[model samples]
Target: AQSVTQPDARVTVSEGASLQLRCKYSYSATPYLFWYVQYPRQGLQLLLKYYSGDPVVQGVNGFEAEFSKSNSSFHLRKASVHWSDSAVYFCAVSAGNTGNYKYVFGAGTRLKVIA
Candidate 1:
């Protein structure tokens, strides 16, 4: 079985500060990793995803993630954050065959950006 874990339930960062949200996974094989952000009352927005090829994947709004196979981790990073970046971020993993893929989501990390 595949599972994803976000160690921090909540993270606070100052505006314009750098941020890194940790995400770890447990899977026998390399699974598809994704980072999604959810704004208040809004749907989950895809921040970044890593399926293959590059270990680092760029996402929208200056977001990016790096997939570490050895560490079984996919961590999200932003050089600088804004007030709009404050949201609940979720790390998810998709495993199984092409059509039989199953997604396991993390508990999510709520980010609070203060001035």
Candidate 2:
């Protein structure tokens, strides 16, 4: 079984500050990792994803994530965050066995960027 965990329920940062959202997962095998952002009253959008290749993947805007197989962690980072970056971010994991896949999501971290 695979599961995702986001320890931070909410985070507040001043505009232009750097931001990092923590994500951890547990799975028996290699897992597909993803980060999604949901704006107020809007659907979730993919920020980034990792399946293979580089351990670090570039996402939309200035967002990026680093995957650590040893630590079973995938953390999201932004160089500078704007007020528009205020949203709920979710970390998801997908691992399959025998053609049956399991997708699990974290509780989500609500980010509030203050001007």
Candidate 3:
């Protein structure tokens, strides 16, 4: 069984400050990992994903994530954040075969960017 843990339930930062959201996973094998952001009433938007190849993957809105196999972690980072970037961010893991996959999500971390 694969599971994700987002330690922080909420995070607050200055409008232009750098941010890092921690995510840890437990899985038997290396699974597909993803970061999604959800606005107030919108659907989940794919920020980035890591299946294979590069350890670090770039995402939309100047966001990126680095996957560490040994650490069993995939942490999201942003060089600088904007006020609009404040939202609920979720870390998810997908396992099983190509078509038949199951997704496990973390308790989202709500970000509040203040000026």
Candidate 4:
């Protein structure tokens, strides 16, 4: 079975501080990993995805992630965060050939940025 675990349920950081969101996954075959950010009342938007190529993938909004097969983890990072970044961040994964492409979202880590 494939699954994802986010160590933190909520994270609070001051504006302009660096942020790191941890994510761990379990899967048989090589998995397709994704990071998505959802603002309040809005749908999810893809932050980054790693399939085969580069171990590090970059996404919009100044977010990036690194894929590690050995550790089975893909953690998201940002150099600096803004109040606007205060939303739910989700780590998603799909095994092998990407099912439904619909994504299995993590329980989501709520980020609260203080100014």
lDDT, each prediction: 0.94, 0.94, 0.96, 0.90
TM-score of 2: 0.95
| Model 2 lDDT on a 0 to 1 scale | 0.94
Tens digits of per-residue lDDT, candidate 4, 1-115, equal: 6889989999999999999999999887789999988998899988889989899889998999999999999999999999999999999998767454545668989999999
lDDT of 2 by residue, 1-115 (tens): 7889999999999999999999999988889999999998999999999998899999998999999999999999999999999999999998844364767999999999998
lDDT of 3 by residue, 24-67 (tens): 99998889999999999999999999999999999999999999
Error of 3 at 41 (Å): 0.9
In model 4, what lDDT does residue 94 have?
A: 82
List the candidate 2 regions with Cα displacement exceeding 4 Å: 96-98
Better of 2 and 4 by TM-score: 2
Best by lDDT: 3
TM-score-superior candidate, 1 or 2: 1
**Which residue window of length 10 is worst by lDDT in model 1?**
95-104
